[model samples]
Target: MNSTSSSDSNGPKSFSVNFNQDASSLQVGCRNGYRLYELSSVDSLELVYSNGAEDSNLVERLFCSSLVAVVSLTSPRKLKVCHFKKGTEICNYSYSNTILSVKLNRSRLIVCLEESLYIHDIRNMGVLHTIRDTPPNPSGLCALSINHENCYVAYPGSSSIGEVQVFDAVNLHAKTMIHAHDSTLAALSFSSSGTRIATASEKGTVIRVFSVVDASKLYEFRRGMKRCVAISCLAFSLCGQFLSCSSNTETVHIFKLEDPHNSPRRSVEESSWMGYLTNYLPTQVTDVFTQGRAFATAYLPFCGVKNAIAIATIQHQLRLLVATESGVLYIYNIDPNEPGDAVLYKEHRLDAVPENFDKTDKGRSSSPQNIEGILGSYAGIVKGNPPGQMSGTESDKLREMAAAAESPPKGAFQFSDDQEYPPLTQISD
Candidate 1:
């Protein structure tokens, strides 16, 4: 969801970076405040807005919209929704625990905690539903569909194994459960269409793609056989035709979804040693070799640092954007037809402000938790119908009903589960 790393004690304090849903923009949060940049082109990163009043640990933009969701490191339990252009706080809410991750789309906003999830209507910021007692997700890892038609939210279904629970944010129910891997889950992502979901386990040797509708396995990719890597990000291209994965290593792997054999270049061949041994080895042993390999790879300047990556098409060219927590953005160009190593196009420093950028408030208007044990109180109470096509009237009604519901308080609350069944239950102290 976000990449954070510490610099030298004499250097600037820690900084956090995250890309917008489509990777069209980048947001960097630091000890002083946050900065927003628009990927106007491959050669330039336009500074749209900047704020220095408060310390922001996390800041997310809603597809270039003016609204932004922010969380301060000093008060991680509190979430503030603000209108960046107007510099006004729209609303804020506090949870019983620290907020780990937050995801947003056109229709819904999802806030993930250690063992719970809160779904809010984007229109009114009203609490639509709460998924309590989830598996202990210390990373606060979760993914939301960009397609508002079938807005699905995915999180680790099991703490011991790599299981994914897909929730229908629009319909407000659990969609299905996917047994993604044998090891614990490390990363999760949804295709642009919301029809498929990708996951990687803690082992980080394999990547799996599942059909969101049936929870059926679609594609499996073998990242490496030499070592176990820590996968940090999984992203699908806007066209949903390609998937890119990044890990703690220096190499970023890219895989094609359809017609892999037709690629101009590939990492492995059927006539190679693994291919020859496929007939002699056991089914399980040979299956690893049969799995797909990287269609293309990108090498980073440094490894083991926190970074975020995304795939996008800019100026009719496929691009890979890697933003490292060390305050640098690396842009790579990839030939879709010829799949191999990615070419580094340009690199931008996020820590530096451009001379032409405005520093005044009057400048251009800018675009912008929980305990595991207490969660056992209510387990299966959260369920939902399979997401079906909703009529316009039905969709509007759902939004209206959500907007009419009572909203949480506009500030922080020190909640206790014993005093209230649900942590957000408003009670006067």
Candidate 2:
């Protein structure tokens, strides 16, 4: 189904949108103000709060909560913390350089500048720690895991070869540093459990998942090799079993992690031969054999798509919310057990403004009157089943597919240890 927002002459020229942890609340930053809407239904939008601002560049709702922080597109960027319910500005903090990114949960708030990172206590807005001389991160790329107790943050380590600096979020102590890739870094993400970190380089062909504790490499999946691509976002499933990545292309790829705890059992005949042989081999040998295996891939539903700007996944569900540069949001429901790509479930146009949108009235009272219907149109698109649980049949099917896909084709020549492996090649979508 298709729904469009009415356009007004005074409407925002652009928009910056963010969704809460569970995808329940959506906060949109526009040129004049930021709007908070409930995403429970698509037929109507339930406006929770609306705050007027001048040239707002970013609006982020705190993880799993209603309190929000906003940043304006002005010099010496500052972040304003406000109550989403009362529309009152509780506090505001200023920075010397332009703010690259801001991340917050119930306990902490993280702000990234060009060469530094500031960690602040959320309760009283006290400065917890400041990391200086950080790697040059122009995009302001940083990731915080969902785990509260052992919260972990991952960011670029140096301006040299690609490296990731993982640290304790609470005490600001250095945990481990991973020399992840050869080219410049593109993105970094931490798993939901805060145990692993995923890194991609500017080459964008290989994505590596590393252990947060020891800085050891765990899994490496290949995205493409023919040409260099810039990765925009990387997200780990809530269960920490799958990693999803979207690049400056029309496709999104999902890679499965090696989880013996939840993996399906192998067949008796195959397990006796291949599994037994591989079980006795060193881990280093096994990793070389099993690199670059992607579970599934899908393309953006829109034609002439520029790129995927952001990606969000629901816990225990195979659904994905993908946002594109054209102000379109697509919901994809994927079946990992199946061998094919993900299918588009629904689509919503996010840039639509209300008919009576008044840019002159710069106050909270200027919120769209038909908010329920306007916001519902975008929220209702995601109304459906929550994340699905894997059944025995599906698990078995996935195992069979993974085994077949990971194995080399019969009669294919194998490279000797002394021989160099051919350059990785990109497969067409």
Candidate 3:
């Protein structure tokens, strides 16, 4: 899901900042503004800087704009969004009660308040629709997001018991629901492509991935040493092959999923301490960058899938640094000429300033549509089982055989539903 604002002709003064685009260049953004510097060689892009205050009316909290639109309502005591190039006011709609969560879809508007979930049409300003599509007396929503293409909607729920659900973002349909844990679900996120889903819960920081087609659980993860850690933020790499999520305890866990099929790469960064893990796995040395003290996550758009990831963490003096959980954000540079595998980038934190709208774009379509396709042929079944204690070899083989026989690669199945199905009579959603 995404939080976006259009720019008007008279927005902030336009600046043509030419970037190195190479891995060696350093870029930064923060309370101050944006700036660039060279890696090994001493050089700077000496542009006049602006320390602007943040936009007050803008609220989408956490913004992840790939194919899906992801936003949250956790800070500022109100909804807030990431600042965009044009601007950062994704939606004009407001709520009467405390906003629990917000999701910016490519084609729809979905928000979850303290007690219910809502689906709206981005095209018409009027209420296109509403769905209390959750269990009654829902404690509240912690996180929310739509797939990159806005095909499905996901939200984390932790009420009397904890759980998470993936629904048809368009029709408010409950396609498949998982009774994930005996505890509450802490976070919900989707791969940038909208093909995979991840949910972290209090049940020992277990991160579960599911296929979009059947909404069935696929890969099971035992990610880190932090126990009972709940996820605070999630960011998918541009290529969708890697996922970065941070927890309250100043720990970021990077899980690599197999490309295309998205099968769990099976190798999770078991610990945030980067320097030593490299001794065992060579390619995984990158995990060291995520070693920051804290994080406010925002994914950057780059050409590669796993290379570009931006995370913001709160420091003692309100400083922000871009890092993966590997601690590499601080010392590692993508530049070959830079010293060490660790390259530290900079962040721009100007004196909080409101965005100048004179040159921003605010043109919004009455109805925005990001329908990739109706979910079809996507199916998987996961029964509650303790983490290890696998069935006997014979049983495991049988299970694998059964799984192979029935479960084809999920992408092969197609959603044949005509989407045009007339509304059901007296819909009780």
Backbone collisions counted per model: 1, 13, 71
How would you encode candidate 1's per-residue C-alpha lDDT over 146-203 as one tens digit per residue?
A: 8888899999999999999999998888999999888999999999999999999989
TM-scores, all candidates, are 0.80, 0.70, 0.48
lDDT of each: 0.77, 0.62, 0.38
> Which segments of model 1 are wrong by more than 4 Å?
1-13, 260-280, 361-429
Give the top-scoring candidate (lDDT).
1
Better model by lDDT: candidate 2 vs candidate 3: 2
Candidate 1 steric clashes: 1
Off by over 4 Å in 2: 1-13, 41-47, 260-289, 302-317, 354-429
Residue 355, model 2: Cα distance from true site in angstroms: 5.9
Expressed as tens digits, the lDDT of each residue in 30-148 for candidate 2 is 66677766655544555555555576677777653435778888733777765444344544666777888887655567888888888866544556688889988888978776665
Q: What would you estimate as the lDDT of candidate 2?
A: 0.62
Candidate achieving the largest TM-score? 1
Better of 1 and 3 by lDDT: 1
